[model samples]
Target chain A: MLDTIRRLVDEQGRLAVAAEAIGDNADLYATGLTSFAAVQLMLALEETFDVEFPDRMLNRRSFSSIASIAGCLHELKEAA
Target chain B: MCQACDSFLDRLFAKGVLHETGVDGLYGRGQAFEAVIEGMDRLITRLAEGDHAEVIRFPPGMNRALFEKSGYMKNFPQLAGTVHSFAGSEKDHLALLDNIHNGGDWTGGQGATDIVLTPAACYPLYPIVARRGQLAPEGGLFDIQSYCFRHEPSKDPARMQMFRMREFVRIGLPEQAASFRESWLERARGFAETLELPHHIDVANDPFFGRAGRMMASSQREQALKFELLVPIESTENPTACQSFNYHQDHFGELWGIKTASGETAHTACVGFGMERLALALFKHHGIDTNGWPTSVRAALSL
Candidate 1:
């Protein structure tokens, strides 16, 4: 999971650095994760896990970070 | 099908309504309006549950500075609606009142700020995500429904000054972005088909930049990168776009400083459903008679 995030950060450049500075609890929306980017991340997660993300999980909290995403994924996996 | 839509449309044409403004432009009233609202409510509720799409509501307008920084002004100056500020002295204010009383153009004297109404629902989401820490070696998703505004005025029911957009956004790696878009293309098409709407998946080209926008419209027919789910709502000859599948290719992630868990530029994609347009399409296809519709369709729409 960390590897995936690391890769995302590296590719994302300064945003990755900003995210690190903000720490996990900081609001991603406030930091800079525009709505468009959130959608992009959602697509990536869906592909990575080979699972379809339920629509209900599409919210600010769900996309908060790797931890929140992983939690959502775990829930999805368990449901499956 | 909402009976209100039928009556509204019928009355609109019967009266030969040429052009109207505001929400009234679309004639949202009577039986047609009620049917449309009810139908949309039911459809959205079902989709929210079935797709697990979380819903977020944004203010009608967005921050002006953010919009300018996002390159919206450069991309769509014509479609842009700017907010204004008032910085006038008492004399200026009194003069403005006098001008209004005299039927003079008072709008010019307000000294407004250039804030814009949000053209798309997802524009605000990126800055929000950027505030959060980097993705934890994984990406994220968001489902947002927003009241979007665009200044382009069209008489067609498919186009409106204000509209509802349901968007599913994915932010992550390039491969992930491609895959997600691919999957959604299929899913969106399926959704439309379920409603008995005939749709074809085709590539979409960005609306041409600058003077080229006009040429792009013509060229789009040949180089179909922009994919749209077309259904007949206002006109049978020209199908209206009910849904669109877009692969933005990290344009936003780069702009907003969003990164994937791997610390790389994230690719982005979205599936947008124009909820009001869909409701309109459904009404056109199924007619406004709730009683005459099929049981299964009625059950699905909860009419």
Candidate 2:
């Protein structure tokens, strides 16, 4: 799930460096993942995983890093 | 961003149209700018007089408690500026003076006041109208203007820490509010055209906070709840929003318990013009020299 989330970030995020350059807990915003790109990633992730991100789960911390996104998605899946 | 724009700023300073106080995003307007602004205010009054709006004046500083209720801090925390005052004993005062003497953080002793500087002109009106109970059968219209503050300070002349927003707000049924927003948006477009500004209207949103703000912004766009009239003031590539039309869709009405004649939550909408931005747009398009402006434009502006 972490690898897949990292792959998605590489494909959709507006990152300045390759996904491989970032660690699992690296700060995405510090690495230049913009809000505009986050929305695009969110839409793609919702479609890819068939899991809708609820209002309570949609925040900067949720998309702060690949590890955090994986964590949130895992929680969402568990609840679902 | 161009030499011409910078040159005009200089000219504005020279001609007393604008006075720069050595602080970024803060300027003192001279008679010329104020005159033009007054004329524009008259123009707005004329255009909206037919609507018979009840004019309400809100002091620039709003009640801090009421401001807290508006949830402005939740959405635009970065831009919110709270009014703080020094409320300390003599010892604390001596310490504050000592800190200031040493050029340290003297503002730490300052406490929050009963007021916070107004962030938007329409914010104060919501609570005021809500307390009035149900609207009359014909609904309600309000005209208000205030000096609004945002914490973003920049050298860009268009982006100011303090500016004026002249707003016309309507409250009633959902369809009434929606149509009022639509109709006024066109009127605003026409108002820009009268000044011969190159303009465009597009869906826009308030700069929300953090990651959650991005989702809110996207949802706002998808739902088409807000729109902005963009004009080239600082840059043509990235036009500034000089005027905005917004439909709150019962957000404030529900929060404030404002009911309609039918005993339902009344929807609210507002169309506001950024007085300074629009003025800058006019100067950009017509050049800093108003004498060189087209006769029709001058006649329309009554300048």
Candidate 3:
């Protein structure tokens, strides 16, 4: 999970600093993660866990961080 | 204009249109509206078949900073809508209110917030996809549709402040991107043909970064790259661009760390249909009384 967060941070470059400033659960959208980038992350998550994230789970909060994403994955897996 | 087209336009105008703030004269009822809706319904039914199972809906708005990073503001600064905040003392507020009441210039000292209306439906999907790891060999696809907003302030119903966009996106290898886009082109063409709408396809280029956008636009004409599905709804002279197929090589993947199962950068492509524009096109072609329309076409759209 940390690896995933680190990778996302790396991919974001300067915006990752903004994410760190506001803490983990901070609104990543506010920090600088564009809608385009957010979608890319969602696609990556689906590929990683081989899970299909339901329409309800696709939102800013779900993609907020590594921890939030992992939590979503856990829920999706258990529901399945 | 046909009588049916006029009635449809009247009905649409009768219903008060809700438009985004600062964007006026861009939407309303017309033959274009009817045609666009009909066309969109047909396209949705045909595309919502096998392999395009998942139906995803995205937020109508987007993050402002993200837009800045995506170069939307830089590329189309004229069409960008910024979210802003008012942080002033009581006296400042009162003064501003007075300015407004007195018909004075009130556009001053507005601090920008970190949010913006989503310009495109597919943009918000990228970050969501990137959160997961690389895709497996076969790749993945998503069907997303949303109400997208743009700041084009044209009275032409075709250039709306807010409009519907349905997109089929694929993330995988380069070959997969090409194949996905090519398949969509065929499907879109067939779908349009069913509606008996005159359409054509051509290659297109994205408004690239910096000085390159001008060169790219010129080159688009030279190469006939970007194909637009044009229909004469708003103006007979200028056909509206209702749909487009875009191939974003590794640009998005590189920006968001999208990778294939093999750990290589993935290619992305999307086929988008402008639901509103298509609807308008349909209304223009077919009369307002959809009940009298062909049974098969009506059944296909579930109308």
Number of the top-ranking candidate, with lDDT as the measure: 2
**Tens-digit lDDT track of model 3 for B88-124:** 8899899889999999966786788887878888888
lDDT of 1 by residue, B1-303 (tens): 444555545534443322244543344434654565567556646554655544677887888778878877655677777777668899998998899899998888655465578888888878887878576555767788777887767656667767778788878887776777777777676677666766665555555444324333333333233578788776667777888877776778888888888788777788788877876676667655546656766666666
The Cα RMSD of model 2 versus the native structure comes to 10.2
Question: By lDDT, is 2 or 3 better?
Answer: 2
Sorted into a CAPRI-style docking class, model 3 comes out as incorrect
Residue-wise C-alpha lDDT for candidate 2, range B1-303, written one tens digit per residue: 355555656677776778898987889997767767887898888888788899987777898999999989878999888889999999999999999999999998899989999999999998889888889877889999999999998877789899999999999999989889978987887898888899999999889986657686765676688899999777779999999999887778877889999899899999998999988888778877777889998887788
Give me the candidate number with maximum TM-score: 2
Candidate that scores best on DockQ: 2
Clashes of each: 90, 0, 54
Q: Output the better candidate (2/3) by TM-score.
A: 2
Listed models, DockQ each: 0.02, 0.12, 0.01
RMSD of each: 15.6, 10.2, 16.6
Q: Better model by TM-score, 1 or 3?
A: 3
lDDT measured at residue B282 in model 3 versus the true structure, 0 to 100: 64
Chain A TM-scores, per candidate, are 0.72, 0.93, 0.69
